[model samples]
Target chain A: MSRILVDNLVVTYPLFNRAKSSLDTQTAPLDAGEDFGGAHKRLVRDRRGYVTGVRALDGVSFRVEEGERIGLVGANGSGKTTLLQVLAGIYLPAQGRVRVEGRTTSLVNINLGMSSEATGNKNITLRGLASGRTRSEIEARRTEIAAFAGLGEFIDLPVSTYSAGMRMRLNFAIATAFEPEVLILDEWLSAGDAKFRKAAAKRMVEFVGQAGILILASHSASLLQENCTRGLWLDDGQLRFDGPIEEVLKAYEQDGNRLVGAAARA
Target chain B: MTPTTKIYDPHAARGVSGFLSDLWVGLSMVELWRAFAWDEIQHRYRRSALGISWIVLSFLMFVAGVSFFFAGFSGRGVESFVAYVAIGYAAFIFITGNFVDGCQVFTSSSVWIKAVSLPYSVHVYRSLFRSLLTFFLQMVVVIPILVWAGIRPGAVTLLFVPAVLVYLLNAVAVQYLLGLVAARFQDIGHLVTSIVRLMIFVTPILWVREGLEGARALAADLNPLTHYVEIFRAPLLGEMPRSTSWLVVVVLTVAVWGVVAMVAAAFRRRLPYWL
Candidate 1:
């Protein structure tokens, strides 16, 4: 029964211009004859001489039902992070509505809410608690998470003393320890050596298998193709294509190459 | 399944009821705050040698030092003066710590603030819990002082519980107000810190109220902070607080919460953006 419905969703963040205007009406102008009212007004220079807003998600909408894995493909600043944040309820859309009918958790950043001064085992409890898990829940999973991390005796050491790869292993294990109805991840899953990556990938596959709705934004075509059943291509904050994973990815890569070639020629 | 559509718009019209509901939702997340508060308390003592007991040791030193200097000047016996100053100083640390640290409640937890869906007021509670823990640790120092001063508690001392409850409510309200303001204006944190440091001298934490003759006495009577200190101090010192102290604390609690509710209603939705 778990599902998600996003209707005309829009997420905007202020672009503070310290010394100069951040907005460029010369390149990106409001469409003519369109009523710049309500949720449709994407951008305009405000009277406030310094700060303006960037419309990260502009009139974007999608729907997903149980057991649906949707891959999100977008270039930099194309609103993939903003969309994931919207799904996670961290960023409220400036316009439109989002209805999610299940417990949702986002693994946007595994290192979030972690203290470098805290030991690896303590961080498991810390992150578990921060993610809204109870003390006993974390305690029950502590051994498993520690084993999966493979840090062994080092788990007793503070995270500050651990290497980057070791930190990633601990973070990834803690993040994927719990299963949620809806799972959202933004690139940063790929970590550790090849062998560890394979293990991490296996864990993600199992996590996604249990989730009702899985949304992953990543640049890895193989990761998306291997996991997601459907794909969404985003450009300039707009949904460019939506279809089966292979088809959408094919079109997206073609468009990307074409733009690159054209730019090189010019 | 019916999909519930929720539109998040800071510009949307929000009334008193909306504010109350937001506060209720934040308050109901007891598990989150309990963990966060415990984490705050433990995080400080995690790597230290003496751990959280450091606060108790420090409190003892402060009370002993201040009592040595001021007891003889007050013309009261050192034992009674130590009891008076011990309660006042412990209560002083609790109240002023809330004021100064409350300003950083939202700012310090920006990571959780931007990432989590829990109530913003939960951070306020977390701050209060840390201060309360330290205050309790300092209160342990009071028992011995009370014994030496020969101040036996009567039934009226039970009023300490309600007085503390009221005091905590006021602390939460002020923390919310200051946290929101500080989040918006970073300078306010430093301003609050300076003001709290200055307030120790203006308020009667170390000095006796009876010794203040003219304008100082009026200042002590009018200062909201003085009432907060007395509400907790009087009970522990085995003396009943003046009814005026209770009235001021109660009125200030209501007024501060009223302002907090209004400000939160108007700006709660905008907090993430402001941050």
Candidate 2:
């Protein structure tokens, strides 16, 4: 079976301005009885000017089978978005490896290189080509894509004139035009009014049906339950759990409540 | 008998070859670049009655004003001063526009950079292409005037070819380094613009290099913009560039800045968070 494997992935970010530590004391002089005034002053001075790194992804290992739909659930700082970016080949893993088996189209930011000053038609061509559609294919499907966006009169108007919802509609339409073997979606898909939302959801489901492998990162558990068979739970750059969608969702809900309760208690 | 055909999967593990293939896919994003260039041009001239011709008109007006201004000071004839100042100003504008705009090449598109999975080099290339398009448009305004002034075109004008390529390469290097630094520092973007403004006067754009005094001559020669201006002007004006000096500048530019670019790209993944 075809699959995508990410082995022991680690992404570390170096802290900028390491010298700020040394300079901080210079900016705000330590008081005589402050923490630095005690025995800890020597330790603080010694540690200054040394680079510290934040581990954004730590040994994230996963294997996604072809044609499987997976939901990635996590908190704000969790590695869900990072994992999707790594799979899309945007960010290289600092350690380990990622191997994929098909053409991937990431809907991470549907309007990713689209110019606001360009027309909807222009953005359609630009976004479509970026998503891996050939020029001929984009030309062939131009009408259908424009119609899908439902911005008929405004198609030729600059996208800066288009409302936020209208732009998102155009982005969603162009992104879904090309069939991708591996499809990745970030949280930006949940825009538009009720009517447009229904249309977008239907189109998303259709795209996922044709997608060989799908990974979606969203905070909405209900959406995951409806779309994904498997779920991966991430927390603080670590894979906390991976299992059937229902099982992981249940654990996630409880874990979220526990954190909320602890905060309330404090 | 029915034949079994294998479908090509772009995601398959071809190792380093796969990465290179993906890079090729990224490089094929020239359509995106063209679209952005069109967008920039359209946006700049959107509401104007003169429209895109204003790009040419403005450049012509600039050359005219500077030509007259410098002619009186240099004690040169109107014809020769116009040619010299026009060529110098035109080349300087192209080089500085490319470099200054390139400083925020990625930073200006921070949203897109954070969102897209394409190669970071695409942004640099797009900025360079847009600047080149504007430069070409302005050259249309300058070229006819040069021809009318009896400055006949020569084989030296061909030097523009390699000169443009080197300028673009240097712009890419600068963009890559500054893009990362700007992402981190945030203040560097404003600082770059200020430096560009200062560089305009010091680079001899409105005057001949020979008109400068001793200390000024030494300073101008040390300015990277001097080498770039010489590279383009030497050929278009039928003069040979100082090969040794130009060579040193090119080598230093590529080597010193090239290493910084590699380091920047190596750490580019952290940029989104830093920004």
Candidate 3:
């Protein structure tokens, strides 16, 4: 029953302009004539004498149902994170429609999930409850997570004391521990070494094999090609291409090289 | 299976009804806040030798220090003055704690907010639970202080229960209000902090409200904190709270919640964007 249907999703974030000691970035204009009326008005120069918003996702729409392993490939600031965020219910769309019909958990930011002060064992409990899993579900997965994470005796230690790789392992294990119907991941897999990544990918594929959805946004081409069967390529906040993983990545890389080559000739 | 259609449209009409349903949904998830609040409390004490006991020790010290110095200044009997200040200061700190904490509630939880799709009110409840836990832990000292003041516990003392229930109800709404406001405007956080610090002087925690006159009496009357403190403090002192205090409490609660409904309707979704 888990499904995602997004229709013309648009999202915008304000650009805080500080003329003084802060870094001042230029205001990106809003593309007009979309279905949204009030959101289009937000980008006009305000009393602060600055264009207020950058449209992160502009009318990008797609749909996915149970058991789809989709890879999102895009450059920085190309709305990859924003799309995942909308799916995970972090950011509400400014216009259009988005329906997510299941329990979804996102590992978009690795630094965010675990409390550094809490022990790894406790974080699993805390995170499990936050995800609305039953107590028995959490207890059932606790040992398996420990074994998968390879934390061993380190599970009893506070997360603050662990190294970055250790935390990433724990986070990955904990997130995949209890099976959320829809799982969204960002580039957190890059934090681990190749062996850890291999083990994690095996777990993810196995998890998705059980009729769960996986939407992963990562910068690594190998990670996407190895795990995802489908791909979404985003450019400048627009959905540029969507198809088989190889074809999408091929178009995405060619366009990147084309832009760079054009710049060099200029 | 019912699909959860979460939508945002600029043209969608949001009024009081929209906010109430949003509040209802968030408030229903009690399990989320309980786990988060308990984790937060433990997180606060991590790596510290004194651990959770510091909450008790420091609260007792604050009550001893503040009540002792201000006891003679009130021109009231020392024991009664201790009792008044103890109860009044505890209430003052609790109220202001909610005010200050509510302002930073969302911004502080920006990490979790971005990572999870948990309801915004979960943060409000989490902050409220932590503040109430701390306040309750500190309020434990009030019992022994009341004994030291020679005040006998009676049926009237039970009034503290209802007063606190009202206090908590107002807290959820107020926290939602300030958390939204301060997240978008960073300056408001400092403004709220300074205003709370100034409140200690204007709200009559250390001094007697009964003896004031002229401008001083007017300040006490106009200050809403005066009524909030009295409603909680008056009960523990074994007297019925003044009818004016009850009226002010009820009226302010409604007014604040009314503002919350409007603000939530307009700004709740935009709040995450602002942060």
Candidate 4:
């Protein structure tokens, strides 16, 4: 069984100044003295020139169980991407804890490690390896991925020669070729040509069907309502609501309209 | 069925074990690093007509040119001088390549570092393997030079393999230490390249170590790089390396790794943020 439990998770991004005066500038500057040390003394918040950290996820916490397809709804900079990255094991949290079980496949950025100069066939292997697939595993699924991508002759051509939609098809196919226990997606499958979209959606159904846990972040409420059974609404990096899809969507819409009306009145 | 929990704490593993654990995870992904290394080699020469022959061709020309020019000045035989320069140059390229490019290993892969969940050592290994591949390609040039110089190897020649392993280990330590440092301080990459360039001249690559006498020879003996070069170059040149050179290299390897462990323990987690 798969599970994800986030306890008071806080992720901070340190903003470094142009003059990086914190650490020694020479060989293996190993946290010598003042920088990133000092357990008892509090960090210097504001000084002449020092690193400043931004709290991207400010003490947000949630639990995700097996077979729960969760839709994460939030505005820009509402920590949706940050939450997904944290779950995917990309970003390390600063102040709290995150526990994730089972093997995970992240589609947060499908084009994460692609080389445009390489052909689609080469990219299939490259992307597969980048996503933690072995050579034999990627080889076994090579034909299946190619058939699903339907790039045909273009698979032999450099990705630079392909159109944007074609590139998206290759990326989508490579990502969805294998299913993991936990699947994390940042957005919908809104790429490729019209005909390819139907095939891609069919592939998504197969991928999602096998996944024990699915966390999707997107702006489209209809898509979430159609796919996800549970919903999480975030406001300013805080969990505003976590409930059934319809109820959370209703509450989120009400809150958005109220803010818009208050702005209009002012 | 019951659910399993895997807690990921940013500050969980501290000190030496943290470094070892990360190294273990990165090394576990050997296939990934191999693919990355092969991809780099292919990408570099994919458009060329002769492909990796360019490495051999260029190296051959360089060793020949340098040996001929230096033979005229040093009064040494052309064949022996060519063999010495070829072996020395090959070792130099391998060591210096890892140092100069290893600094950029993390910074160059910032995209993957920020997005992927793999160990940071994966990037370090990829850079090292790419340099290794180049070194192997350049080794093709050494065979003909050795054959032409009639330098036959006995049981002592087997020592060359172990010497190479030590060099590789030291390269890895330096790469990990320098990779983390260079990521935080961007200028360190350029600084490393400049230092390596200067060291190439001082460490006796083109010039023979015996040419310098007395106090000048002591200067070369004091250089750590001279010891590393001697350990590898001496065995291939059909002479067992001095015990002092072997001792210095072993000590240097341990010392370098000691520093690497400290750096890894302290800054391994903060590396992504710095990038």
TM-score of chain A of each: 0.86, 0.83, 0.87, 0.81
lDDT of 2 by residue, B4-29 (tens): 11121222323444434433554578
Candidate 3 residues A1-266, lDDT tens each? 57788888888776676322121324434433222322434343456555667788888888887889899998887789888887887777778878777677788887886777778998898788777776788899999999988998999988989988998898889888877778899887877899999998998999888777899998888999989999998876788898999999899889778868866886
Q: What are the runs in model 2 whose C-alpha is more than 4 Å off?
A: A12-55, A109-113, A190-201, A256-266, B1-27, B211-216, B252-265, B268-275
Prediction 3 TM-score vs. true = 0.90
The sequence of per-residue lDDT tens digits that candidate 3 reaches over residues B1-275 is 23344554553336666667767766787876787788889878877999988978887787678777887778789888888887887788888988899999999888778877777888898899988887887788778878988899889899899889989989998899999999888888999999999999888787999887899898898899999989888878888888898899999999999898888888787776877
lDDT of 1 by residue, A1-266 (tens): 46888888877786544334444444655653122222234453367544377788888888898889899998876789888877877777778888777766676765555667668987887677766678899999999999998998999987888877787788778877866677787877654587777887687678767746788888988778867899998877888898999999999999889877866886
Please report the candidate that would top lDDT against the real structure.
3
Please state the CAPRI-style docking class of candidate 3: medium
Q: Please write out the lDDT profile of model 4 over residues A83-156, one tens digit for every residue.
A: 98888887778878999997776767655556666789988887787767778889899998888877899999
Candidate 4 lDDT, B1-275, residue by residue in tens? 23335576678555789889888888888877777778777878998999988888889899878887787665557887888888888899988888888888888777677656778889888888888888887777788788888889888888999988997898888999889989888789989888988997888778888777899899999998898889888888888899999999898899999999998897788886787
Which ranking of candidates, highest lDDT first? 3, 4, 1, 2
Q: A2, model 3: CA deviation in Å?
A: 2.1
Chain B TM-score in each of the candidates: 0.93, 0.85, 0.93, 0.94
Please report how far candidate 4 places residue A171 from its true position, in Å: 2.7
Cα lDDT tens digits for candidate 2, A87-170: 877666667878876666676765565777788888778777666567888899899888988998899988888877887788
Query: In model 4, where do residues sit more than 4 Å from their true spots?
Result: A18-44, A47-51, A130-132, A188-201, B1-5
Give the TM-scores of the predictions, in the order they appear.
0.90, 0.82, 0.90, 0.89
